[model samples]
Target: MSASLLAILVTSVLLAAVARRYDLSSLLFLVVAGLTVGLIPGADHISGIELDPDLVLYVLLPPLLWSAGLESSYVSLRENTRSIGLLAIGLPLATTAAVGFVAYRTVPELTLAAAFVLGAIVAPPDAVSASAVGRRLGLPRRTMTLLGGESLLNDATALTAYKVALAAAIGASTSLRAGLETFLVAALAGVLVGFALGKIVVFIRSRLDDPLAESAIGLVAPFLIYLVAEQVEGSGVLAVVVAALIAGQRHSTAGYAARLQDRAVWKAVQLVLESFAFLMIGLQLPAAVEGLKGTSAALIVTSALAVFATVIAVRLAWVYAFAYLPRLVPRIRSTEPPPVPGQVFVVSWAGMRGVVSLAAAFGVPLTTLSGQLFPGRPQLIFLTFVVVVGTLLLHGLTLPWLIRRLDGLGDQQRADLLAAAAAQDRAAQAAADRLDELLSDASTDVDARAADVLRAWNQRRRQTAWERIDDEGVESPMATFRELRLEMLAAERRAFLADRDLGRIDDEVLRAMLYGLDLEEAVLNRG
Candidate 1:
């Protein structure tokens, strides 16, 4: 299992690297690699690399969810509330009902409850996949925001739906009213858990000054929220998301270096996890399909087609209606950002189901409490794999092209740059103010040098921001200086590499010098 796990990781990295050169997302490639590798000769004997439902739900999900929540901007969430709410809540409900009906109609083997189980299993669009692919393609910021916010919240909704549907499948009596109440309780409890944890964590973080220790806290934070929420009968996923948002909003108060380091660490973690996840999806294909014993291949395949088309069609209709309907409402139209043509198409088509769907499918109980076989566990799993793979391939491969065809980045770049420039100006002013405050009473000897360095850094920051705003129609004096400065820095880097190569300088010493140079260049070339 260890060796196979290692193989999955290595293959994921290789495929991800290859994916960078193309239009496909790394997730897409990794899933493909997983499927291909797991089907190769000896796969049955050699590879135990597959999704462990419990591990993914409890251990893996928290970090992934928290990292996303922390990275997401609360301000953006509010700005895009209407669209996100509709898609996150409304779309999932619509998809579930539509898919459930289709499955019940097309697949006679599945009871209504079992059919709804399949619906809930595939309902939520995977948040991680949306963030990964949508960001990579540089989807419109508002579009990505709506998509991202939708992904983060939809899991809890879909899972709540899944739980209610699952209980029925397992012979536990249930009702829509009970399901709705349970969903509300779980969601509310999850939020409370997250808020309480966020406060406690912030207090602890304020007292701990060590950057490494602080980062370690970040690593542990999501799981704490998740477990606590579940223990209290709440939605663990929602708890993690809320906790992350709360902690993340306050994270700016921590030391800048600590925050930066934490960000980098999470980036690496998400990459590894995302890669492993999609690969696991692929690895599970055989197991997913193996349940076809005694089930007609044609019927199941046809059923897969019906489920896929229904998922796609429902998303398209729901998103378009949601996007357009608000325009007729005077109040909503006044507050909402006007829809950009084709943006809805991008968001609708970006609905590539991924890890969460598979997790839900795998999580379905194998047998009821009476010990009779579950009505449709195997088919549920098989159809899930089909939907995940189907949407991922179809959307992941085509989204970039569709985006380009639509000229999707229109006006978004200018809006982004303006927002960024304004932010840069504020950050520079803040740093300048801080430098003065620190050097105000510094020991006399260090004050002059400190002032000079700080002044230079502040000027670079201020000037760069201004350049973006009020272009000169010709090179700014700062631009000329930056070009020359980069030339010198590059020369210094080359010299450092040569010194290491000549054996005159130890590699360690060479790296130390290069690190200083890198810092200097970064300041001079601030963008």
Candidate 2:
């Protein structure tokens, strides 16, 4: 990387870290900081940093999608498929049409095609912020799952629409029927490509014992799947998401070492990429503004704010419509419970646009096929910038307060914990049964003390899970055990390090012992 880019990354990361320290939205913080810096005198170098559209779509997006997919709960996703599908596919298309129509009517200079391009640009909400806020607020599992699943697939919807709209803007023939066909083909091809690659990766990783090699493959897989799918005229976003979901489903079968390394590596990668992307969203503000030189300031402000309002309003309507309208059917009402108004409202308000919108705007063609300047290209880009930053500041800042006000979800969260405790109890019982079966075998030579230790461990695991649902003030037995066990583990770690320092233990032996201690601590913390 160039020194300038490295500096930008460091600066962005620092701003994000500060935001995180104070429980602020890091993405919003970075964007605001970037905008502030961009406006400073002699900060042209920062604001002038140009990014290729392909860099955002091809290079930056895939890994982020992959990371989210890997971390997603397959069970939750399956259960909430209908909700996710509505938000991912339907919402994007609706927003594209709604925003496109609004933009076309609002900006006299903008062609219908170019307006739709702008619409597609800002249509998809980057759920990174929504997911972060939802997680921090301890939103119910189903809500989080819907957010995760929507984030994974919504990009595909927006980008596919973007392609069709862009083709029209550049003077290519496109009709509603053709656009629908294109979307269907892209979605199908992407899923097939991603599924095939995902299975291949899983099969290879499952057979491999090398953590470093597995990690390398995991890192490369996203980009590879994206490129291959796009090469076949499919939605690269869908391909990456599909491959990630497939790979995530098999994640537990991987070696412990690979899983540990993956957690550290992917976490760092996500932080760096997300920070840089959010900062760039802000840093590009000057260029976006510079593009509209000589344009009426009043016109610019009115158009931008109008588009922003439209974006927010459309999401609210779409979410609420989907949440309730389907349940009006007698059959549907009988099959599914009514949607929680609080959850639906939270989902609606969490629609913050991100780097992708800016990237799409920046990618717009400067000139049409007839060699005429693409109508309102500069204005559209500026409008997109405004919408992104405006939504970020508006929604990102208020979501926490909104979630706090609508606090009825606490009961649902507690219910989820109770369900988890029940599941843990069954799993622990099964483990104990398997242990007994192993011990009963004549070929097994385990010590009686070792057998007792295993049995106690299983019982403790069950108790720990159940303890989570106990009264908050209660000092449960499992909690006490965890506290004491953690202290003991810390002591063991210090002893191991002391032995290593005194040259009494080999480095490899120390690492092995430390790994064991770390795994135990991880399990305890997880419980």
Candidate 3:
């Protein structure tokens, strides 16, 4: 294998192992590992292995973002729409303005347009990073929906604004009216294209008998919609979002087989894509640092801190102001869900930058309208890298601790409610069991065989009884069964490890065995 490929494989394994052991986000480990590798003499070659930014952005991001959007419950999003709107649309604009003002003032050589470009590049939070961390933290579904929705919409808005800013930097005059008109047209065009493409895919999916082939189409849908949308000068982000949403909605409603296959395929695809994205993110750090050569360390540090502070401060202000202000008023309050202050705070802090920002920053044109090199391109890229890494590490590491401190731990009441519901379901099963038995004992026994099977199921569904117990009660049959399963798992793991150490079983075989054992243990514990 080529060194780059080898590096990726080795780094991936190492990061995965470390992340699992330490209970850390895999993204964090992947990035840190990439940086370490990049610092090595020959590792810079890995940075030179470039792919097209458009391919990564328009092609890759849409599916990933769309997947996140599809997974988001529309009901939750509707509940938090106002807060999401304020954060996604309102916060980005506010942050851009704040950063633009500061950048233009601090860097006298940089034009106002250039300042805005910088702001726009850093404005949108990364949906992938936020989702990965948030899910692990057990954030409320509404909070996840708001964060996902905001991140999805903001990418398009920020990118659009960035384009305008870039044009202005090259001395192209832009009218607000023209910008608005363009945005509306582009958004509408994207929606139309997305719907059209989605319908075609849905038609194909419906007719396709093979689950694998149908899933393959679903995987390719985002890239296809994105490319088509971009060709028509539409919002590729919006197109992808709409396409994924349409596919997900139609996925289950289409039929049982389509739903089963699509769900399985999409879940696997999501895991692979997410892993690749984060690993790539880690590998880019050395390149970013190298791009900052000759720039004053102090200046870069100051600018990064200033930009980070501006981004965070602006978001906090926007969330608090917009989300709470409506509640204080009677007239507009009727329209929206009352924002949860804690959730808003969490969302504000979850603004970690990732692939989109990196791609956009790097995609900054090398030459202006007059063919002059774009001013401060390298510095801008480096600063953007700083913000992405800083926020990811800082927030990702501290978030769990913060949740605990804020008493955002798993809600016991919610868990209890679910448990109670489960108990009620068990009771219903018991009643159904007696009914089946009564019927089974009767002379009219045409479905007696089915009833017998139903009774067996009810026996399995018996309600778990919890009672104050002495030592005798503590060592129940279930507990004894669990102890035996644990012993079996330990023995199996030992055998696998011993074989692996002796080279009789390869790592893959060993890993598979261990995974199987782990799964069995999980099932046993659940029982």
Candidate 4:
């Protein structure tokens, strides 16, 4: 097991590094790595590895979700709430219904319930893919923000609907009324559970004296949030997301060391787990196709294509309606600006299915209540796998091209920069005003050195935007000072290495000196 993990880590790191350099899809590269490595003869140690659906849902998903929620902008999400709501809830429902209907029609052997299950599985676009590609392409802030927020929340909707459909498929009674009630109750309870857990985590972190221990609590927070919600039969996905959002907002109040520890640990965790999950997906091909030797290749291909089309078509139609329909109403039109058509098309095509769909596919039960094999179980898995591959390849690879071709890049980012500059200008002026008030006061305690540093920071912050726009673009004095400090640190680093090579300093002493130089360099370089 350790060897297998080491092998996966090495492969993921190599592919991820190459992808980063070339600006290719890292997630796709990982998938390719998995598939390519699977082809190697006598590599059963990795190709033979198996993953359970519960292991994915329970063990892997929470942390990934938490990291996403923590990084996302709460204020930006709130601003795009209407559009996000339509995409998250309405779009998934439409895709599920359309795909389910197509599946039922294309494969006569599939029952409506089974078709719906497959539909639910493929409904939500992968959050990892959207953010990874969107951010790299320098997408407008609003478009990227919308994609991030929608991907973060849509899992709850799709997964809840998946359960309801699965229950029906398994011979349990299901109704529109009961399904709606269950969805509402589960969603509300999940939020409440997350809110409660968020507070608990905050309290725990406050009491923990060690930064590592506090970071550990942050790491486990997602799991606790998810498990607690699941224990009460609520939506675990939402629980993790809500708790993460709350915890992230409170992070500002945390000790600097605790925050640094949490960020460092979570960064490593995200890379390791997310890479493994995507790679593990490709490794599932052999298992996904098991018990299907008798199935016709043609049937699988046709059904997969049908399902894929349904997923893509429904997304485009829904986004079009949502984007344009509001413009026709006076009140709505005045409230929110309609989206650019080109950008709308890009967002619609960004709906690439990923790990969540595959996990849910493997989770499908083999038998119903009557001890009979579940209808179309193998076909369902095959079709699910196909949709993931199809969308990931088709939409994921091409969205960047379409954005460039259509000139769909919006000005949200430019506007945001302008707003940020204005805000910074005001902040700097306020600090200046306060400093004046302090200097004017007869009885006020002020440290000269500290006050000078504070004043410099305020001035630098205010001038940064203006300096960037100037033709010369020369570095500020503060920046130049930091650059010189970095050079001095590098000199120290070289001297330590030279002493170690001459045997004047032991390896341990050299390492300790290097560490100090590194920390000092970090501050200067970061500045």
Candidate 5:
């Protein structure tokens, strides 16, 4: 198992490289690679890499959710609350009902309760896939925000519904009223837990000096919050998302070192977990198919097609209906303009199912309370794998093309530059004012040359920002300055390397110098 796990990691890395080189979605490629590897001879060990349901739910989910939440903007989330709420809360429930009804009628082996369980499993579209494609294709900021915010909250809704549906499937005898009560209690508890934890963590980290210690706490936070939420019968997904948003909003208060280190750490963690997840999806294909040996091929194909089509069709209907319906109200119409049809279409098609769906399916108990095999457990898992793979391939591959075909779509580059320039100009003015005040202090010994140099650099920073906003193709003066500066920095870097090679400077000294140069280059590149 260890050797197989290692092999999985290595293959994931290579696939990641391929993804970067080709500028394609890693999720798409990794799953295909997993399927290819699993089908090949002498690679049975790869298939033996069992995806532990608990690991996916407990170990994998928390950090991924936290990282996502941490990066999400609270302000944007609040601004798009109505849209996100619809997609996150309303769409999932609607999808559950739509798919449940379809699955129950279409699949012979699945009971009504079991059919609902499958509904809950595949309802929430994975935000990671949507966000990845959106970013690569430069989707509008508002569109990105809607996709991200919905992803953060939808899991809570779907998972809560899954619990209710699963309990009924296992003969626990639950009612609609009881399910509603459970959801309310879980959601309320999760928010309280998240708020308390977020406040406590922020306070503690503020007092801490060590970046490593702060980062370690960040690494532990999601798991700790998740376990606590579950222990209280709360929604762990909601708790993690809320806490992350809280922490992210206050991220600027942290020391520079902690911010830098935490950013790199989370990126690495996201990469590894996402790779493992998508790969496992494809690797499990053979097993999912193997479980259906005795089932009629026609039934399997029909059931898969029915469920997959229902998932897609329902989302399209939901997104389009809600996009225009609320605006029919006079008050709503006055406040918000009608959404562009293209953006609505993109959002609708972006409903790609991911690892969470598969994990939830795998989590369905094998037997009922009466010790009988859970109705259609094997068939349910098979359908889930089909939906997951189907949505990913179908949506993930076409989303970029769909986005590009929309004329003038997401053309916000110039607006972004203008906004950035305005902010930079104001900040530079404030810095110059502070410098003048410091220089005027009678008690301080301020050098005249140093003050002039500082003023010049501050002025240059302000100029660089405005210059970047220029529509003209010709290079500005600051651009020439940057080019010359980079050349000098490159030469300096080569000199340091030569000194180290000649034993004239210690490696530690060389590293220190290179670090300084790196920071300078980073600033220059930003300009």
Candidate 6:
């Protein structure tokens, strides 16, 4: 394999192993690993070391955002629309202005317009990082929904504002009419592309029965939507977000086989892609730092501190202000829980810049319209990198502790209530055992066997419940059983490999058998 592909494969597996062993986030490990490798002598000179900003922005970010969007539930987002809107749109703009004002005042050489442009580039929190950490930390469902939804919308807003600011910096007047028209066109085109792609994917899914092939198709859908939208001058991020939402909604309603295939494929793809993207982020650090060699450390520090504080303070202010707006409206107020101060704080703290910011910072033109070298281009990129690293490390590391300190830990009473409800459902199955037995007798042999299995399961389940009630505890024996099963599976896999090597089984047969074993292992682990 080529070096780039090989590096990706090796780094992905290593990151996974590291994440599994440590309590750290996988993205953190990947970033560290990439940075470590890049700093090695001669590593930066590798033939495949290209870090094209456009490729990262256009090719990488859309799918990453789309994946988060697809996994998000629209029902929840709709209920939290007020909070999402406040954070995504209002906060980003506020932050841009705040940062612009600070930058213009702090740096005499940089114009107000240029400050806004820089602020816009760094305003949106990274959807990928937030989702990755939020889900793992067991953050409230509403919080996760807000973060994901906000990132999706904020990216487009930030990019739009950046363009406007950049145009103004080049001495071009802002035409309100033209700006509105462009925004509408971009939004319309993205929606059209998304719906069109969604329909085509749905059609293909309906026609295809093979799980593997269908899963492969689903993997390509996000990239396809993003690229097509970009080509048409629409918002690629919006297109991917819309396409993913449509695809996910359709998948939920799809037949069992298609849904199963989609779940398996998406789970695998998400793991691989998330790991690779974060690793690349880490690896790019050396180049980013090198670009800043001649810049004064004081200047870089001042800019980083100013931009970071501006982004954070503005988000906090906006979220606090508008989180209660739904209540004022009366009608929408009753639909969802009013976000408390704590929830608003969580939303504000999650605004950690990542791949998109890096891409946008690097994507700034090398030269201005007047052919002057984009002033402070290297310094801007370097400072942006500093902000990304600082926010991700500082907030990402402290967030869990902060949540706990704020008493935002998962609610034990709610968990117990859910568990009790599940136990009651099991009890109901236990009560229906006799009825099931009678029904099974009148059915076919397969039904009879299935019924017998369920009856035994019901009996065991009831016994466990009684034991739990009597002893006030229930021990999980499934863990021991799983370990034993895994050992047996490993032995069987080894035996099969030996057979294939000895010419006792064909390659196709061995592959099929291995695939079955792997699927069984996954199911067992889940159980």
- Give TM per candidate: 0.89, 0.94, 0.80, 0.89, 0.96, 0.83
Model 1 TM-score (2 dp): 0.89
In candidate 6, what are the lDDT values of residues 1-527, reduced to their tens digit?
Answer: 25775677576767777786877777767776777787787776532253567767766676676667767887878887767777777777787788788877765556777777778878877756666666665677777788889878888777777777777666678766766676667778887898888778878876877877777787778888888987897877778877777777777767777676666666776677667666767767766776676667787778778777777777777776677655788786777566656667777777778777777877778777888877666666766777777777777777767776675446433454456657866776867766556676756345657766876666654444343333224455644555788999999999999999999999999999998899779866641
1-527 per-residue lDDT for model 3 (tens digits): 26775566556766666786887777777777766666677766775443346756865687786677567665666676766778777787777789888777665446778888989989988866667666766676676777788877888788877877888887677877866776777789888998898888888988878877887788788888888998998888888877777776776566655566666676766655555566766667665766566777788777778877787788778877876877778767776666666677777678787767877887888778888877777777777778777877877777666655664434533554466657757796778867766786756564767776876555433432221122345676556656886998899899889999999989998888887787678656642
lDDT of 2: 0.89
**lDDT of every model, 2 decimals:** 0.83, 0.89, 0.73, 0.83, 0.90, 0.72
Q: Which stretches of candidate 2 lie over 4 Å from their true place?
A: 411-413, 506-509
Model 3 CA deviation exceeding 4 Å by range: 1-10, 48-51, 254-260, 291-293, 331-339, 408-449, 458-527
Winner on TM-score between 3 and 5 is: 5
- The candidate, 2 or 3, that scores higher on TM-score is 2
| Full candidate order by TM-score, most accurate first | 5, 2, 4, 1, 6, 3
For 1-527, candidate 1 gives per-residue lDDT tens digits of 67777777777767776877775578877877777876797778434344678778886678888888888999999877777889888888888889999999988879999999999989998856665655655677888888889888998899999999999889998898998999899999998998899888888887998989889998988887798999999999888888888888888777877887898899888877877788788888778877789988789879999999999999998988878987999998897677877787888788989888988888888899789999878888889989999988888778777887885456555566788888888998899887777777556345577689879978877777767656557788778888898999999899889989999899899989988897788777655
Score residue 369 of candidate 6 by CA lDDT: 84
Q: In model 5, how large is the Cα lDDT of residue 426?
A: 98
**How close to the true structure is residue 135 of candidate 3, measured as C-alpha lDDT?**
71
Clashing pairs in 4: none
> Tens digit of lDDT per residue, candidate 5, span 257-342?
89989998999999988988899888987667767878998998888999999999999999999999999899999998679888
Best by TM-score: 5
Question: How well does candidate 5 match the true structure, expressed as C-alpha RMSD?
Answer: 1.7
| Alpha-carbon lDDT of model 1 | 0.83
